[model samples]
Target: MGTYDYIVVGAGSAGAVVAGRLSEDPGTTVLLVEAGGKGRDLNVKIPAAFAKQFKTGLDWEYYTEPEPHLDGRRIYHPRGKMLGGCSAQNAMIYIRGNRADYDAWAAGGATGWGYDDLLPLFKRAERNSRGGDALHGGEGPLFIEDPRSPHEVSERLVDAMVEIGLPRNPDFNGPTQEGAGLYQLTQRRGQRWTTSDGYLRPARKRANLTVLTGALVTRVVLEGDRAVGVELEQGGSRVVHRAGREVVLSAGAFGTPHLLMLSGIGPADHLREHGVGVVVDNPNVGAHLMDHPMYLLNAETTAARTLAEAESPRELVAYLTRRRGLLTSNVGEAGGFFHTTDGLAGPDMQFLAGPAYFWDHGFATHDKPAIAVGCSLVGPRSRGRVRLAGSDPSTKPSVRFDYFAEPADMTAMVTAVERARELLATSAMRGLVGSELHPGAAHTTRAELEAQIRAGVEHTYHPSCTARIGSESDGVVDPTLRVHGVQGLRVADASVFPTITRGNTHAPSVVVGEKAADLLRSGVVAGGRAGQVA
Candidate 1:
């Protein structure tokens, strides 16, 4: 194959958007390489069946090192192993995160990445069903729709939140992210609208764009310090593909840093230990890994109001015919953001209320009707890192989340559990809800709650900030997303997040892609220098 203007590795959220937008000029050729096959699994389409894809071929099924804070349990971290990546596997919630998050990035020396600067890009990428506003876009490639059929229990949860003095926010992606309401989903007519669906699929018809699935990128082909191409394996054979202009890495937080390490770019001491040659020796390449630590507060219900009741032929028929029923639910049907205390810059805690028993990250489900509230400490103080398990690209990286390593994180989680219990105990849910399931009512003391948190806390499936954009002292990528001291190379993915956003990372990941495409199209190179397009 001939060299292309750009070689985008990993056809996930960011890679899809980058390739799609770069190829729009018709003159520029873009190649998107994906390690996984096309996401054509039947479970990928049904919103309610998302958990069914877990531990299967569609999931990478990465597990963490035993968390010292969580009773030495190795938590499962399931990433998508297909074209759309986690977007095809995740609960289709569309959350843009609090504006404060981006503003903080700018304050931390991400020059062009303030909340105001990225808001337009966010609007430009979304086609919200609620229509355009100063904050939302009406006609964009990615679709954001209201839940087709929210469950009664979900409605009651929102009502219960309102009853507890939290405002009823109709849209979490609006001006204020501090309230309770139904979650908007990345769906259209009840089907999932993944990045591959919104960006890559349409661009596939263009002759300038080439998509290669099952192509596992092994390392960046570097000349001195600049990335010129990539070494990859496809059809059990290895090949080197060159880039005329640049090579973009969108292989997600874990994969991107892992690949960089394999390509001899990472912490010098660690790479030396693994016998990998040093290229740039960026110390922060795999540091600052962050994720929302969550705990579930579940309760048995008096009536069969959960999704467990919707497993019959009638509900399936209703979904197939009109796209309305439990099948349309994203599992986390309703939720909101709330401050643990007053005067916080943003919501310290976020909730995702559902009608089903969500235990062990939805790997296990109760047979009877039950309602659960997922409370997450979104602003966790604890940080983690991803390291190369070995020099070989085939070996999975060692992921250590080190959750609750900070004492403040544990305090916030305890408060989160208490708040969720309060919501479930509201009068609106009195008649519907029964006894507490996981952390029983008997465990009321702060010490007991703290103990329960230690035993039961899990990840919210939002991993980010492994390779962030920031100042020269602390960041892996610059504000323009170009790797420090490396030319013809950039990263556009969740890994580049300056900080973990307040909500789901899917929307922000897409925003990164859109902005990266714009940066590349404008011929702006690293350090704000003008450059020629290939």
Candidate 2:
């Protein structure tokens, strides 16, 4: 292929938006490279059927090297390797998280990225089902829709929260986020709306944009100090593709930083350990890994009307004909955020209720009858890292997610699970709940709860902060998202989030892509000269 004006590596969540936005200029030529094949799986399109995609060929299926806090069980992490990436396989919840999250980044030396500054970009990138306004966007390429068939159990879940004195937040992405309510989905009608469907799909019709699926980018080829192209492996053949202007790294939190490190952009010591030559001895490249840690509080439910039992002919007919019923429900229907105590600045915990049991990573195949409510620590203090398992680019990297490494994380998780149990004890949830499954009533004491939390907690799958934005002293990428020691390249995605937000990260990740695109198009890098490549 010929040299393009811009080369966007990894056609995942953030890359889709970058390619979509940059190609809109018409004059600029953009190329998007995806490692996996087309993301057109039936399970990917069906909002409720997403769990089926896990561990499939389209998924990366990464597992963290045994977390010491989780009783030495290597938690399974399923990342999409398709065109839309995780967006194609994730629970379709749409959340912007707390506004304080953005403000905190600005306070941490990342200028012009506070809540107020980033709101416009968030609005510009979304087209909500409720339409556009000061808080939401309507005409944007990304489609955000309401849940199609929200089950009655979803309402009961919210009612249980209210019965336990929690307020009802009609919109989690609205003025307030501290309450239980039905969550909006990243869907368009009954179908899933991934970044590819919202952004890249439309951009493909444009002559200026070219999307190459199943193309594994091995490294970001650097010409001395400047990144000028990418080396990709296609059908066992190595090919070098050049970029006329700049290269954008939107390969997500894990992939982007991994690619950078492979191209000799991480710590000098780690580079030598992996037998890779050091180009820019940046010590903070793959550090500061943050992810949302959570645990499930399961109870056998008396409610016969659940997706768990909806495998009947009637429900099958409903799904097959009009795509309505319990089968259409996104497992996480109703959710909430609450403070562990009064006088706190924001919510310390979040809740996600599923009408059916999720034994492993998702729903089990057997006739196990249970309902689950999961609690996730919104702001975790623990940190971890991602390192090369080998020098080979195709090899999966070792992810050490040091969950509950901090006392605050364990405290928050225990409190959240306790709150969930307390809510179920209320009359609203008592009508449906039968008996505790994981940590029963016997595990109520502080010590017992703490132990259960340490043993039972797993990832909410919101891993970020590998290449976070901040001052050069503390981050891999600067406020403008340019890599610290690398020139002509930028990293955009959840990887750039200094601290992981308090809600579903998909919407926020898209927002980052939107803002990063604007910064690159406006010719403004961290030091004022954008096109000059650092």
Candidate 3:
């Protein structure tokens, strides 16, 4: 295969930005490889139809190896496999996590990754419909807009949270995050806008950029301690593509670690068992996994026409003709960050409420029109692990989030349930809501609520930190995102987050790409940028 200045694996959220930004220099050549096809499905464009892509070709459709804490249930983990990755598959919520998250990373030995350091990158990647501010960007690729049509019940949900003792905040991304408001979305005119749209699409026309779809990277081709290129199985043949400067792995939390271990960059004993040569004996390759375990509280709604009728003829007509209707709803429509207890640096929980019966990844539905309020344990102390099931790159890795493994994790979730119940009973929700559908009247006590949470909990789909940024003693990637024992290689996705962000991971992943581009460019020391590759 041909050689390029940079080879970016997995054209997902961060990968798309990495490839697009690197190719900005016309003198540089970049190749972006994606395992899935271009994400152009009609459902991908419709914000409300995001759940329709789950388990489809666009989804990786992964399942965990049975969590021991949650009655041994094998929780489903759906990841985007196509161009924009989860950005094309997510609810389009445009949230950058708490400022404390980045500051913690710098404190934890991830130098130069502080909130002040990355704020510019976040602003640089944005094009808010509300225009520029001290905190937002007005002229960038990513488009963030208010909901085209907000359902009355969704608005009431925000009011309900405020009535239940939270402050009313018009802008969650403004000075503070501890308040209730309708969320802005990553959309333009009611259509989903992904990093693929913001970054990749415009850059694809560049002569120096080459994008290959349906290409699954098997492993890194290492020349001693340096990653020279990547071996990918595209079509029916396995080919090697050389990276003249560097090989950046934006293959996500799971895929990046999987590819690293397959390339003999993991624990020496584990590699020996798989009959593979060991180049680096790092044990932190697939450890320290963390995710926000979420629970949805649904209630029958006699006051609002929920998303059950979103596909009806009238709604369809409105969406088709004007792009303004229930079809434009991003299901978790109105929400805000909150704390389960006081004096925390930031909120430990988030409320994502909407006028819909969202459950079991939207596969399970209710007979009556209803509203759903989802609470995620954003600040969990629990960690998990990801290990290869076999030596084969085609096999999915074995994962277990070990959710609720820490007693505090369960306590916070229970507190979240109590708060959700408070929101449901508030005067703002009195006429709009009915009987509780999940963890109903029977589960009221602390223990009962804990049981209900264990039985009914889901997640916010924010999995991260498997290849976290740390010293060689604790993590796979260093502060600069370079692998500990490898040269000319780096990991630039949620995998490199020192700790999971307290909110959606999409926007931060894009920032990771922007920061990676700067770091790669800054590597020009004594020679030309490409010629300086180790």
* Model 2 bad stretches (over 4 Å): 363-366
Name the better of 2 and 3 by TM-score.
Answer: 3
lDDT per residue (tens digit) for residues 323-425 in model 1: 8898889988889799887677899899998888889977776757888899988888899999999877889999999999999888888887888888888
In terms of lDDT, which candidate is stronger, 2 or 3?
Answer: 3
Where is the poorest 10-residue window by lDDT in model 3? 525-534
Best by lDDT: 3
List candidate 3 stretches off by more than 4 Å: 524-534
Question: What TM-score quantifies how close candidate 3 is to the native fold?
Answer: 0.98
* Candidate 2 residue-wise lDDT, 1-534, digit = tens: 459988998777788888999999999999999899889988887777788888889888898899987889888888889887888888888889898888888998888889999888888988888989889889888788778888777788999998887898888888988888999888776778899998888888999998888889999999888888999999889898988778889887778789988999998899899999999888778789998887888888877777775567898788778877776778888899988766656787889997878757774443656788988888888999988888999998889889988987887787888788888888887678888887787887988988887777777878899999977788988888888876788888889999989888998888888988888888877555655744
Scored by CA lDDT, what does every candidate get? Answer: 0.88, 0.84, 0.90
**Pairs of residues clashing in candidate 2:** none
How do the predictions measure up, each by TM-score?
Answer: 0.98, 0.97, 0.98
Pairs of residues at least 3 apart in sequence or in different chains that clash in candidate 1: none
